[model samples]
Target: MNIHKFFANDEIATRPLHHVMRAGIFLSLIIIIFISMSGRPLAQTIEYDLKSVSVLKINLPVSQAVTIVLSDAVSKIVAANAEIADAQPITDKSIYLVGRSFGTTTVNLYSESGAPVGLLAVEVGVNSADISRSIRAALPRSDVKVNTVNGRVQLSGSVNDAYSMEKVLEIVAQYGSPSIVNVITLKGGQ
Candidate 1:
């Protein structure tokens, strides 16, 4: 009877330990699940493909001109969104007239009511040297500089006004689509 009593005590002690172990395992699993869920993204990210939306390739002269003009307007719209993402300000704008002549093109940005905000004119061709010279001529006051590498031109400088940015875009548009627009990416600020 004493041995039987001892066995009963052992069983009682083991049952509590088994329950404690299961509870600990359940708690560990719950903590791991909570940590994993917390690490997931909290807010959905907003994404935009500037190139896909605005970049247009042109070859025919008239088509090139028309497309570039359209693309400029499109770029403004797409760029406005990008600007919003980048924390820049934008307003409704349009181009009254844009024309290309002798590797040079003129661009005019107008407000929604047709009031002009800026005018930019630029020249470009297959020759980086000529394009560089044209940019220098177009932006004589802005210390414009050009870099060409592997069929790409990048323009960097400080322009006195927003017109200079339009001018830079005009230059790039002359070469090709916004994606490969002479490789000339204009960076303007301050």
Candidate 2:
């Protein structure tokens, strides 16, 4: 029997394959268009609320660097004052901020899509290493521990007498007043 004659006798077998092929092509083209459109920008400009800008306060030690992990991928970072601090992108979602001087500056992070992420209020100050050494040398008989937290010098431990405590406070004040939290206790007092 002839193939065409045999197929023509069966309505199911004679169904046009071109119709199925065309339907498949149409479906594939629709999927491709949807995917391409999803990636394209809907508008030319992205608006941001300037009045509701978020601010992050960060304290870093002079000559030291700290890493800040962001909620979104960062494309660029700009420092308000380069002389006070330097910000460099380590990855798409993090940045390394280095303190250059004893001052405060702002760092603005930009998203990969060119939108402002937020502002970082970075304060650069002296580390506690030098201050700790000086305090230890001045009060060799007393036990004193010095640390820095949130741009403040924290002094904790014990002193021999009130004079020693006052001396420690005085030395810390020389560096920066109102930036010292003295938790030092007298030997005989609570």
Over the stretch 2-69, how does candidate 1's per-residue lDDT look in tens digits? 11112454573334555666878999999999999999864222222323433222111211122122
- Identify the leading candidate in terms of lDDT: 2
- Candidate 2 lDDT over 13-129, as tens digits, reads 633566656878999999999999999753222222334648877767777787776666668899999888998887777777888877688999777688877888887776677
Q: What's model 1's TM-score?
A: 0.28
| TM-score, candidate number 2 | 0.47
Candidate 2: residue 42 lDDT (0-100): 38
Error (Å) of candidate 1 at residue 140 is 1.4
Return the clash pairs for model 1, or none.
152-183, 153-182, 153-183, 153-184
- Displacement of residue 23 (Cα, Å) in model 1 is 99
Name the weakest run of 10 consecutive residues (lDDT summed) in model 1. 79-88
Error of 1 at 30 (Å): 94
